[model samples]
Structure formats: C-alpha cells, structure tokens
Target: MNELERSVLAKIDQEQLARLCRQLIQAPSENPGGNEESTVLLLQSLLQDLGSTVHLQYAAPGRPNLIAHLGGGNAGGGLLFLGHSDVVPAGSGWDADPFTARREGNRLIGRGATDMKGGLSAVIAAMASVNQHAPHIPLTLICTVDEEANALGIEHYISTAEAAQYLACIVAEPTDLITIIGCRAAANLQVQISGASAHAGRPSDGASAIEAAAELVALIGENKQKLAAAPHPVLGPATWNVGTLKAGHGTSIVPDEAWLGIDRRLLPGEDPQQVLDALLAAARNRIEAAENLDALKLQIRGSVQMFMPGFLTDPEAPLVRQVCTTLQDLGAAGKHGIWTASCEGGFIAEHHNVPTVVLGPGEINTQAHQPNESVSVSDLHTAACAYALIALRQYETSQN
Candidate 1:
C-alpha cells in the first residue's frame, strides 16, 4: 500500500466511530414511516467537514439519500460503499429502550445496532481516517433510506445516469467479519384468497375465505421442501417462508377475504415469476378441492418489486483479489464465499453490474433482529481497520 493508504489506516478514531453508531441507532428511522432526514443530514455534515462533496436525493418526500465523494488522481472506475439508514421498528419486547442507543460495557444495544448502524459507522469512521491522509482511491459513500421497508431510495439511485460508473461496491451489513461474495435474493410476495361471507347460523350457505387460506397455507407448507431443494452453484438452495396471514373481522361473520405474505429466497438461477406460478398453482389445486367451498379464487398481490437478482463473484476477480490482498495486509485470514442470507449484494451486482461484497464486524449467529441486539466493541475497531486496508488495496490496484 502507498504512504497515503497507510496513513489512512492509522488515523481511525475509535471514540468518534462508536459515537456515530450510537447516534444513528438513537435517530429512530423505523420502517413503518422510515424517516431518514435527520440521519442523512448528520452524515452530510460530517462528510462536508472532511473536504468531500456531498449530495442529498429523495425517493419519497421526506426520506433522503446522502452521497459523499472523494476523487482519486486517475479514475478509471471508482469504488462505492453503500448502506441504508432505516431500521425495523422495535415493537414491544425490549428490556432497554430500543431507540436509546444504550451502551453496556463493550456492547452497544439498540434497534439498528447489529442490523446495521454498526456497519454504517465502521465505514464512516474509515472514511474520516482516509480523508485525513488524502486518499489515493476515488471513494464514494452512499447512505440511503427505506432498506428496512422497501428499497425505494436505492432503486431510485440505481435508475440514475450518474450512479453507473463504479467498478465495484460494498454493502456494510453485519457478517461476523466474514467476506460475503454473494447473497440469495429476498423476493417479497403476497397471496390473496376471496370467498363469499355469511352469518354463523347460515354457514352452509356461505364460503369461508379463512378456510381456503388455511388450505392454501397447508399446500405451501407441503411444498416447502421442494422449494428449498432448488440448486445454485454458489448460493446452494432457495428458501421459502410465509411471514404473515390475516383474515376476518369478527367471530360472527365468515371471512370474505384473506391475505398472506411470503418471503422467498432466490438462488442464482431461480426466477421469481416461476416461484409465484408454482405457488399459485398449489393454491388453485387446494382451493378447488376443499370442503364447504362455495367458490374459491386465489390471486397474487403486489410484491417487493425491486429484485435485482442473486449474484456471485469469482474468487479470482480483480476486485476480489485486491480485497483479499488488502485483508492479508491488515492481518486477516482472507477467505471468501457466498452467504445464505440476502443483502444489497443483489442490488449492486445485478442493477449496477458492479463487483460487490459484504464484509463487516459481528458474528452471523449473534441474535440480530432479536431482543438484546448488540455488536462487540472489539469487532468494531477491527472492522474499521479492515475497511481502511481494503480501501487502500483498491487504490494500489488502480495505480498498477
């Protein structure tokens, strides 16, 4: 690595790093109405102070995306570090206030602590360090809103002309410090069942949509193993899940409508449409055969809509090799492979055609999205150092 790169790695400030992570958790950009205005502004102010040019764009009225840039001397293609500012709502079950960004000993506890304001903070801290040393790599930091709800902000950014130039990208999601070369695609789907409603006394004259929904769910459950068996060279198997179900308003009346929400994990070659068709076919068969069915019909509703597709990068790809070398330089073991879960890897690789990977602190088994969510302070410092080293490697490769 060059002198500038070495300097950048050495300048990381641990206190400021932890502060950024905590502040983001405290901001409460929860998915229900995901407000990232304050969070974006915080990053914008910091980036501007570090002599980087920044821009804020919106997907919806209030939500914003912050992009900060630092140019290299000879830029063929720059590297982009992307992550989201929004987090899922912390519903009732917490021992500590989920939005308070509480710190107990070495762990930082909050809604976004591990899923991942911690990842975002690590990258930002690395950026601050790189800025002080005058970076040799052309770097861009993209912080967008709505990742927890939908990816509207990132989808909007990807559709733009100016965002297409990057050669590679990284999404700083929690990964137990492993290098994620690929991720399965998380495709959101909805199934609706409709039937005629009647009073409890006259149940024979009416159809129960709730019953049809139950039958449909049964059909899906039976086929779960089949769906899970689809093979991918890298991603291994696709997974299916029914996340939510709702039917009926009261006990006296038969439900006329029922809704079911599903999360399908796509392997590299699996088509979302095919998955939907298979589900629809199963529902149609089950609905037509069920007892007490006056009339049964199933239809697919709106989906996640922004699926870019699953992706994998060759271990020998230039960017991958560069990152590996950098990690080795930083005293890491330097292994790489595909992760079973989904992340923005699909977006960066499929939408932008950029070589993308997810590498960060924290362990994959550490109960993210569960109560007592937290990240290790030791991992935090280590991840910052790793990101700094990776940034330097990209610059070194570009020069050669």
Candidate 2:
C-alpha cells in the first residue's frame, strides 16, 4: 500500500467502530414506533463533534434524516454515503437483551448488527479517519430514517434539491464486502375484498369476500408462473409471494371483508407503477368478468403500500470500480454482485440518477434481522478501511 493509503487504513480503529455500533444498536430507532429521535440525536452529536456540517431533515414528526458533510462544507455535492438508522422491531427469541450489544470474540451481537448498524458505524468511523487524515476529500453522509418499514427517509431525500448534488452514492447496506452493482426492486401490494354478508346457513344469500380473494390469489399465481419463466441473469426474476391473509370473523356468519398482502419483486428496467397498474387492471378485470367472478357482488381493490424500484449501475463507473478495488485492497472479495436492496440504494439510483452501490460488512441473508444477529469486528474494520480508500479515490478522481 502507498503511504497515504497505509496511513488512512492505520486510523480505522476496530474498537471505535464497535463502540459506535453498540451506541447505535442501543438507541432503538424502530420505525413502527417512530422512535428515531434518539438515534438521530446521537448521530448528530457524533457528526458535529467530528467537525462535520450537520443538519437534520425531518421525514416525519420526530423522525429525521441526518445530513453530515465531513470535508465538503456545503450540501451542494460530494461522494454520498447513505444509510438508515432505523432497524426492524426486535421480535422475540433473543438469548438476552436485543438492545444490549455484547461481544462474543470478534462478533458484536445485537439487533441491527448486520442488517445495517454495523455498516453505518463502519462508514461513519471511516469518515472520522478521513476527517483527520485527508480533510479535503469531499464526503457527504445522508443517514436516513425508516429504511426498515417504508423508505420514507430516502423518499423524502429524493424530493429535495440536495438529492441531485451527489456525483455518486455508496449505500452502507451489508454485502459482506461483495461489490453490489445492481438490485431487485421490492414492493408491498395489498388486495382488499368487500362483499355483502349473510347467515352462513343460507350460503347463496351473500357473496363471499374470501372466495373473491382466493380468485385474486389464483390470478397472481398465474402471473407468478410467467414471472418465474423470465429471469434477470444477475438480479434474478420478478417474483411474488403471498405473505399475509386476514379474513373472516366467525365460521357461522358469512365473511363481509377480506385482506390479502402480496410481496412483489421486480427486475431492473421494470416500472413499479406500470406493474401496479397491470395488477390493478388484472384484478379489476377478474372482478368485472362474470364468468370468473361467478356473479359475486364483490369489490376487489388493489393498492401499493410501498415500492422501491431496482437499480443497475455501470460496472465501469469510477466510484463503483473504486469500491470493488478497495475491497480487494483491503484483502476481501472484489466480486461484483446484485442486491434486493431493502434499503434506498435503488431509490437514489432510480430517482436522483446517481451511480450507486451497496458494499459493506456482514451477510444480508444469513445475519440481517435474524435472532441473535451479529457482525464481525474484523469485517467492520476492513470495511472502514475500504470506505476510507474509496473516499480518497473519489477525491483523486475529482481532482483529475
């Protein structure tokens, strides 16, 4: 490694990264609770102490997106490092406290340990090192809220003038150091079925909303087959899963209402709105068709609760290339890959037209949101080093 690179890497303290991770993990920025206030304050304090120009853009009441500039003093533009502070609710089955971070050898265990608090802390710690070593390297940290529930944090950001300022964006989403250049979009599509109710004893007296919902499910199942038939080589196929179903009150009383929640995954280049429109049309058609509906007096409604479109960055982009090379330089995988970006990488790439990548410590599928979630300190420090080098590389490229 060169002198500058060596010096920067030397400053990436694993202990400090772990400490920050613990602080953030303990903050409990759960989305459903709208409790990101404490987490936002904690990050704001850290950034201010690091000499960053800090500001908070409220995405919701008491929920804010923290913007911190390490070197570039203005919010106009820089290499944007994006992350979300909120984590999924810590559900049951933890051996100990989900909020209490504990170390087991090199792994730091807690909620949000892998899904992304480690990724966030790693990037912030890298910025701290760069602020000390190479203050002229322009960096913008857009730490957002509500990445876990709906992506309102990033949604709010893309609506701002500052969103278009970034030359590139690096999403601090865990990829276990694999360079992610593309992602599959995810969305929540719900179907609400309403029908007249009557006594169950006289079955013909009332239309069954549950039966209409079943027809909707069958329609999506046919769609699922077609989607699975066509697949993106890198990011995989457009897909669907029936995750939730809420219906009925009593077996004796005919059900008046029913709800079905379907999860849709779209490939890059697919418009989320177009997909929604198609599904809505299909559902409406099925209801309108007397043959399919069997003359059931039912109203089936479809709505998109959330939609985060996928993105595919050019592998040749300078920042993207730098990210891959930096991972290799840090003695990790330089492999290019794709993500289902549960976070906002896709939002930034699609809406703001920013070249974006998700590269960070820990495994997304294996560790994120699981009981006893954890990430290795070794991985955190390595990721920090890579973050630092990538910042230096961005600065050097801008100079050239």
Candidate 3:
C-alpha cells in the first residue's frame, strides 16, 4: 500500500493477463506426452518482453526449462518464483475442448488453468508490472517441465550451481489464494514381478506371479497401517498407495508377469530412495516367507519412476509473512496451510536450502486435474497483485 506497491498494482493489465492465461492453457504441455518445448518458448518470449534475461535449458531433448531473471537482484541472492510448465493429461469428461480455454463469466475454463497455468500467468503479469514500476527489485523466475510425471527439469536445475543463491521460493500451485508453508513429498515406484508361466489347471506346475503380487500387496497394506501411527504435525503422516495392478493374460493361463504401481508420500525429512528400498525389502521377505512359493525362482524388482521431496517452512519466515500480509491486503483471508499434492517447491527447498511457500489462484481439490479445470478471473488478478507486492516489499525489507 505504499508508492511502489500501489504503482505496480495499478500497472497490471487485466485483459493481457487473461489473454496470456488462455494462451498458456492452449499450449498443451502434457507430461506423459513429454511436450514442454512450446510452453517454454511462450514463457521465454513473455519474460524477455518483460525485460528479463531468459535462459532456456533442456532437461531432455525437446524438454526445455526457462530461467528468467529480472528487477536487478541483490549481490548474491534474490527472491525466486517457481512455476512448472508441464501439466497433467487433459482426460475425458470435459464440456468443451480441453485445450481450448473458454472464459465463462468469472471462470476461465481449460486444462492447467487451475492446476498452474493461471497462477503462472499471474506471476508473469506481476513481473511485467513490477518491471515497469520497480525495476530495482531482484527476482528470478524458473519455469520447469515435467512436474506432473517426473521432476527431471527441477532435478537438472538444482544440479546447476545457480540454484544455491535463492533467498526464498514461491511455487504457483493452486491454493485458492491460500498461503501454503509446507507440503508432503511424492514418489512413484513401478514394481515388476516375474514368474514361470504355466496352465492354471496345474497350479503347482508353475509359479504364479499374480498370487505372489497379491501377497506383497497385503503386506504393504500392513505397512500403511504402520505409517498411520505416526503423522507429521503440519504436513501430516507419510502414506502409501497401491495405485495400479496388472497381471494375468487370461483366466486359464497362469500369468508370467505382474506389474505394480506404488505411490509413497513422504514427510519433510523423509528420503524417497530409502523408503523404496524398505518397501522392496519387505516385499521380498513376504515372498520368501510365503508357503509353497519358490522365492528364489520368482524375481521382484522395482525402481523409482518419480520422486519429489517434501518441504516445511517456518510460519514466521519473512517470505511467508509477506505473502500472508499481501493476501490480507488484497481482501483475501491470509492463512498458512499445507498441500497434500506434490510440486517443485520441495526440490528447491531440499537442494538449495530455500524456504518455500505455495500460493496461487485456484482450487487444487476441486479444479486441478479435473475435467473442465478452471480458475476464477478475479483470483488471477488478485494473485498478480499479491506476487508483485510481495516481491517489492520483501526486497525493501531486506534492504532496510
């Protein structure tokens, strides 16, 4: 509510913000599709137009990430804004074309609109305003690819020495404008079990991978019970999910292979690899102890398909306070919360030791990944102002 904050807020262009949101939603950077290049290009041009120095780094061929720095940051560090370009597949059950962003009254409808594209657009628009009004504030915006499927883009980013200098990070995930100070981590493991094939008529003739897989599933259920006993105070307890199971070709033939998809949600201090190791070890022991099963002949191997670590920032942190204060000033209720879903914040927090906050413009539970995903147009405007004001105030406080 000072001169710079008021000026930056006034400078935000509402129509342009909505247009950019629609454009990004139309881009279709699906993670399973492995297409984030187009989204990166869109963001690169926008950031460049806003007077940011943009760098395009590919985590994989055709998978590009953008690192844009603006507002003349401080000597060694500055505020960082995190946005992921990739989105989950726009599955069936939409009222219209999922990729076609349709503005219906207050809601802008499309895939990625709620999950992140809306929030991402707000950040860019805020940076545009801030760049015009207050170019002296230091800010870095890193948009990564593949946050939905795997986190290779963020992994690649942290490996670079440039990540170590950030003072704080704001992940533009859907939070309905709530300021999230912590979130649980997510890791995906694909377990494949192999056994000798045989006819179902003779059960003892061949090892049944399906039967063994069932036993492991039951044991993992027990593991879930153990996890329920102890939960984190803020982010809640670690959890396990047996998301998928594929086995047996037909009713008459003994299946030769079994595939299992497991999802583990880790706490702030948990390690993804170590959790997988223990789960696999328990599966092996269960198979070994099972009666009439050939444990040595049966092979069970699993690997981490996607691993995202969790993060918890102190509620008293300046970045958290700034976001909350901004939210309150913008006529939105300011509160600290935790995200059950995973995002790129954990990677920045864990690897770079940056305090991370998740604040954005939409609803995660109701809108994100849902058909006809949408975000409030009003929420987008407020988010733009909030992001800009937070950056300006944070840098001012740091200087003081």
Best by TM-score: 3
lDDT of model 3 at residue 225?
86
- Pairs of residues clashing in candidate 2: none
Residue range with the least summed lDDT across 10 consecutive positions in model 2: 287-296
Model 1 misplaced stretches (Cα beyond 4 Å): 1-5, 73-77, 296-308
Ranking of predictions according to TM-score: 3, 2, 1
Q: Write the per-residue lDDT of candidate 2 for residues 317-367, one digit (tens) a residue.
A: 776778878888778879887776555787777766788888888999998
Total colliding residue pairs, candidate 3: 1
Model 3, span 21-122: residue lDDT tens: 999999989879989898889899888877788889889999988888887753335778999999999989999999999999989999999879999999
Each model's lDDT comes to: 0.75, 0.83, 0.87
Backbone collisions counted per model? 2, 0, 1
lDDT minimum window of 10 residues, candidate 1: 295-304
True-vs-predicted CA distance for residue 90, candidate 1, Å: 2.1
TM-score of 2: 0.95
Off by over 4 Å in 3: 73-76
Ranking by lDDT: 3, 2, 1
Clashing pairs in 3: 73-138
